[model samples]
Target chain A: MVSMLALLITVPMLTAVIAAVCRGRFCRLLLLSGSILHLGLALYCFNTRIDGRWIGLTSYSEAILLVLTSGLYFAVCCYCCSWLKAEECSKKSLWILGICLPLFLATMTLVILSRNFGVMWVAIEATTLFSAPLILFHRSGRALEAMWKYLLICSVGIGLALLGTLFLAFAARMGGVELHDLRISEFLNIKESLNPGWFKVAFVLALAGYGTKMGLVPFHTWLPDAHSEAPGAVSALLSAGLLNCSFLGVIRFAALAPDKVGEFCTELLIILGVLSLATAAFFIIRQGDFKRMLAYSSIEHMGIASILFAVCGIEMTMIHLVAHSAIKMSLFLLAGNLLLACGTRQISRISGLFGVMPANAILFLAGVILICGVPPSPLFFTELVLLCQAPLWLALLMVLLLFMVFAGMMKNVLSMTMGKKCELEIHAAPAERLIWVPIAGLCAALAVGIVFGVNL
Target chain B: MNMAIDLVLTAFLGICLMLSASSRLVHCIRLVALQGILLGVLPLLMWNWSKACPGAEIWGAAFVNIMVKGVLLPILLIRAMRKAGVKRELEPLAGYSWSLLIVSVASALALWLSRSLTIPGVSVLAIPAAAVTVFTGLFIIVSRRKAITQSLGFLAFENGIALFGAAMHLEYGFFVELGILLDVLVLVFVMGIAVFQISREFEHIDADRLNLLTDTGEVK
Candidate 1:
């Protein structure tokens, strides 16, 4: 019980190490085994409860959702086995990823379990480091650029967070609680004792800093570039897993700030969220590159997730997070398959995916339905709940952005799926059918979520 | 009271500014070395002049600072400079004279700002030096074009942070300090890779050229 979260974090990390040492075909088998183990542990973690003096992990529902999300992860891992047949990427690169992937998972788990602000900051920074190699996995010109941008921007943003941490320390000292005796509970206990002025600054900095990682507008400049360039498996982990963990960091601070300050901050988040959606819609409509379009879509969903957290209740935010994960992962993996079959990432260059790879084509269409928040999809219900809870003005704006994004994504996905058959034929992987299983399962989960039917 | 040592230590602030403002690469490197040496001497002077208790840990910290900041880091930096073969800061975004003027103003502002803040139980004199060190580090990072200089700027930034930490009398315990040290080492190694990669790719290490990879979605 004491080590449940630790186990969840460590298992994948350890598996990554072993997988790295095992080369070629053995690596895929190792990854497959690791993913299954990870999924099971995530389920067990959800069922088990652990309490410590400063931390607790008794949220069974979140754990279950987290486990299901691991299904998408495992599926991507399977796809990666064949997708990354490039001989240039060495065994050492895989080793680094193997080590870093688990470390990344462990850090995310740490972020989830940590009730302390300082400890959580460290965990978040650790995530940044672990995810760096993952982003730079391909080591191409574009990948290098993306990794550099991710590092420099995140380091600068996280540096500001460090400044905020210092401010909190000062606030504690001001309240007659010296820095040495500081803890999360101390601040909560003496919430009134903290200098509200410094507290406000700290909260704002933390929000903007961590929100940068969450891919909110303005701080989201690196998102499309990073996501598009990274491998599909990495992209899925990023969109479905990492961003959720970052939001948790922001929510931690939002949970701390009192009334008007919290409201004001949440309002800022909502505006950024809306702007992110609007921005994604604008770009996705005209985006030539399919991967880039998917990248923008992820940003739009992140924005929606942020706004939902800001406006709606926790249940709405939590449900949306899970829905977004399933749909987004399926969407990205399907896109990866298309890229594999077409031999190009250009949207206009290739068409009639349905004829070439019918399974992926259908999966892509369903993913589009799910992402657009169409009925019977969880995102549709979550979007509805968010609109219901938000002010009418904000709701209208959100709905407009939602429609624009939906239209943009629909146009892209439809044209790519059902357009005229290519004059030239492209060979696709025989194993491509495996990608459908995860997509179908995710769609089923989405169906259940939309109905709010599951008692678990 | 070691007032002379205090004055010399504070003079390192001006030297850091001059380094940031300089167009000549070798000269900037020298200035950085000087600043590092000046920062290394700081703990000793503080120990000598401090009316309060000076423990063995403080002395140990001073020795480590001197060794790492004063002698070792600069030597590593010089080796990197020779390896990179970047002689002058070619195509600096901010001109040397303007950079110098801005650094002067920043130093003055930092002094004024530090004086304004009422940090209880701190020597008011120490705060200005710390603040200036911080701003100078910022100036170096912002003004310089070369990755190596920017790295030196980052080191100076840490110096400023260390100085501020000292002024605030905040103890981060040994583990946190060790973690910080490890992070800095990794930072240097990664930055070295960045420098080597930049040089290999473009045949020059100007950060302005590195801006070729911006998010404008334009042709390279």
Candidate 2:
């Protein structure tokens, strides 16, 4: 089991090195195989308990997240194979992608698997570094702009999170607890001894720091630009994989707060969640670019997940996270297909997508429906549970915000899909048949919505 | 020994003030390097005064911190500046006079904050130094126009945290400290590359000009 955990991280790092040095074709093969092995190892760890001295799976929730991250990574890896083949990328750019993508996966895996708060913080910061290049893969002026915003804003935010971690250590010391290392399990064991005042400060800072990474409101200014400018596969991973890892950072820190301070943390989450939802709704309603609209929707869903976690606990948050990952990944990937077909991300410029590319259009429509919490979608069940647990007014606000999002998304979908065909020629390569990838993703989301909806 | 630590801390605070009041990019980078050297020496000074022989791990962490923070990062930033052909910040968001005033206000607030937000078992000056450094770093990031200068602000912010860790006697193993150093190194390296790209594409690293992506307008 320990060996599996070690393999889970090292395989990607090794693959990344090889990809960086090797030619492009071999690099793609290496990435695909490494991701497949990672997914297999993640699945194997589900039933097996692996506890290392410093890094191990501490809870079922973490295990679930690890699996979710790996699953999304595997899917993205597969899609990248087709994406690379289709796009007329330079050899150097392809090599960079080959290197950075696996490195990004490795860092995220370390984030999920590490039990030490310090290690988790390092891994999260490393993810920022590794993923920045992916955002700049296109080398456009706009992509550079997006990459700069992502690197600087997320770095400053993560820097605050480092300060918060130190505060947590300081809080522990102030409470007369002697900790050998900054371990989450150790902190929780002595939670009663932690100074609540300092703990609250740490909580707020960590939330703001990691919350920025999670694309929560106030710090979410970087999200729309980065996601829209990045290639489709990268956007999918940022929304589906990276956000969850950062939220895990928040969850780990929030768990260390004392019961009284935990209430404060919950309130903070709810407030940020509502604000994020409203902010996303406002931008999403008037968003001109399809990819940027998806980015805002990511903020909205992350907000809902935070609110759900506060009200309904980890189980509901996990369910919503999984469902949202699948749905969002599919939407972004399909959006990628649309961009490929029409050579533009502008919603108004795109028309009669259904006639031009029926497979991508259907997938996009299904993703929209699932994302907005239509019946039988797992998000719908999560929303129902949230409404039941939350206060009346807050629940009503959530419903109204979600309705606004749904209407806005439907309007875009109808406009993009049902209008007369534009004169823009479809750049359909042999690799264009990979629309089935997102269709498979949609099926996976539907499966989770049904399976978890019933069991939970 | 206490007087020596106090002198170094005062010097650190003085550099923070200089950072805010200076507009020359080279001067700011040098100030950050000097600040990093002071941060590197802090733990050793504390260990010597307390007569506590920290294990090999502390020595290793101190060495890496000094090398990465004091020497390597500034070198990276300087090379990036040369490549981008940016010499100095022309129009800062806050003028030097305003920045100095804000820094003074921040220092006053930090002193008050240090008294109120006391943690047990840490040096009295730790919180104050951390607070002032953090505020100065944030101010630089917010006030500077050049992307390279903002990167320097991030380094200063990180250095402040390193000082806090030292002040609190928090020995977060050599591996974790090394990981932190490596993270900062990579972050600065990546930011340098990004700044290069921004300048190459736009012919300027002024962050204000990175306004192509907006909500209502059609994306270019």
Candidate 3:
């Protein structure tokens, strides 16, 4: 089973290498085959646990990650088919996508299976290394800057995570255990005996460190730059997939901490999460750049996840993670379609997308509604659960945050989809509808889960 | 003996700060190199007083730290600087004086915070030294305009962390040493590539100029 977990990581990574070296149309086929194989492997892990060793990779969480990543990876693959249609002189950006796509997926898999904290840190850092080049795939001045901010900020964040790992190592040291032995269960088993002060310090550092990657506010400065400037597929992975993996790292640490310390940690997460949501809400309301607006939405979703985790609302968190992944993937992929049609991501210049690219417009409309947590959406249910469990004050705060996101995001997204068409012509092919299939599927699944209470 | 080693590290860490505040990029790089050399010998200095019985392990760890963190990484960084053809700190996003002030404050906080928890493996000197190293690295990462200098800051940050861990008596010295070594080498090379890419695109490697992708949040 451990070997299977290892295979889950290696297969995509190795495939990425092969895909990077492969030429022409073969790159897309190779990437698709690799993603499909990954989805299958994830399903195998979902169905049967290897003696129930890993928590998130076992039973329900494994299924959630698999379904979410598969949906996300599929959207990315589809986007690659269109998004990377290079001009004769244009460098084959597909090779870069091929190399990073699997590596990105593999890193997320590693994060889920990582029982050892040290291994988890390595995986988180690996995500940065794999994705940095992808962010710069366009090789534009904007892409270069975004890549730099992404690398510098994330490296420092991960560096602090390393410090926290060392602190946790220190905590383990006083317990007279090997640093490798600092597993969640092992830490929890010895939680009370370990130094409370040191444990608190470790948890704070880990939260800030991993929180940076998760795109929580204050530490989230790198997020907008990276997300807005990267190719749509990379943006989708950053939003729908990568953030959750880092959240899992924090969750792993939180699970091990004692109740009191857990409260302290959650308090910090909740504060950061709420701040991130509020910050995104403000930015999204007035944000001119469509891609940058979506970047802010990513921050909001991350904040929502952090808040749920803080309340110890695990079911809500899982639903939100899955729902946000699906909805955000739909939104980013549609944004890509818009980019192709309009050749600009500036919201002020883009209007009446519904008329210009009707298929994308409809998908974007659905995605916007779903993101706003309207009725029958999975996020609506998850948000409901979060409100119920939250303290009265927090419930009020969440309502305000949700309303801000709804209003702000609705203003921009609605204007983009509903306003009068500009002079630009939409050159979308009939095959572009395939990209909408996953969005429709996710929306339908979410609707069924909401109404029928399908234990998804 | 531990105190003595701590004092030595503290002095080197001070040199690192002075170098960080220096406006000259080459001087900053050189100071980082000196600090790396000092970090290389830190484990040996700290372990000399330990009653814990050991032979080549401590020395071996020190040798690796010196060779990897001290010598190899600095040389690579210097080469990157030369290749990029950037000298002197360009107009930093954050001012030099403020960056220095923040570093000092973070160092004080690290020192004060160190006293709060009495973890067994950490020595008095190791905590402040590590804290100073981390703070200086952060300042460099945040304030420096050039990608290379920011990376140099990161190297110093790692040096602090490595020294802290060395003090902690993590048993697998060889593995930790190798991990840190590989981490620095790989990260530096990756960072070097990013600098080259930045220069190729922008004709300069200043991070502040790269903020072209802001959310259109100005409420017009």
Q: Residue A81 of model 3: what lDDT?
A: 60
**Best-first order by TM-score:** 2, 3, 1
CA lDDT of each candidate?
0.69, 0.88, 0.74
For model 1, the superposed segments whose C-alpha errors exceed 4 Å read A16-26, A47-73, A85-89, A179-182, A423-425, A437-441, A444-448, A451-456, B1-12, B23-87, B125-144, B147-166, B170-174, B210-220
Q: What tens-digit string does per-residue lDDT give for candidate 1 at A75-164?
A: 666666666562246776676666666667767766676656666666677777778778777666666667666765665566556556
lDDT comparison, 2 vs 3, better candidate: 2
- The interface root mean square deviation of candidate 2 comes to 1.0
Clashing pairs in 2: none
| Regions of model 2 farther than 4 Å from truth | A428-432, B48-52, B116-121
What DockQ does candidate 2 score? 0.79
Tens-digit lDDT string for candidate 1 (B94-193): 8878877887887777778776777665566566776676677767776777877777776666666666655555555443444445455555556666
lDDT of 2 by residue, A264-306 (tens): 9999999999999999988888988999999999999999999
By summed lDDT, which 10 consecutive residues of candidate 1 chain A come out lowest?
A53-62
| CA error at residue A348 for candidate 3, angstroms | 2.0
lDDT of 2 at B17: 93
**lDDT (tens digit, per residue) of candidate 3 on A1-456:** 667667788899889878866743477788778877887777676665542233235446645766677657766776666555531214466666677778888877877776567667777887888888888777787778778788878878887887887778676656555545445556667776665677788888898899999998999998988887777667888888898888888887777675567678878888998899889888888788878888888899889888888885666688788878878877777776677666788777777876666777777777888778887788887777788888999899889978988888788777887877776665656325446544664565476457634553
Candidate 1, residue B113: how far the Cα is off, in Å: 3.9
TM-score on 0 to 1 scale for chain A of candidate 2: 0.98
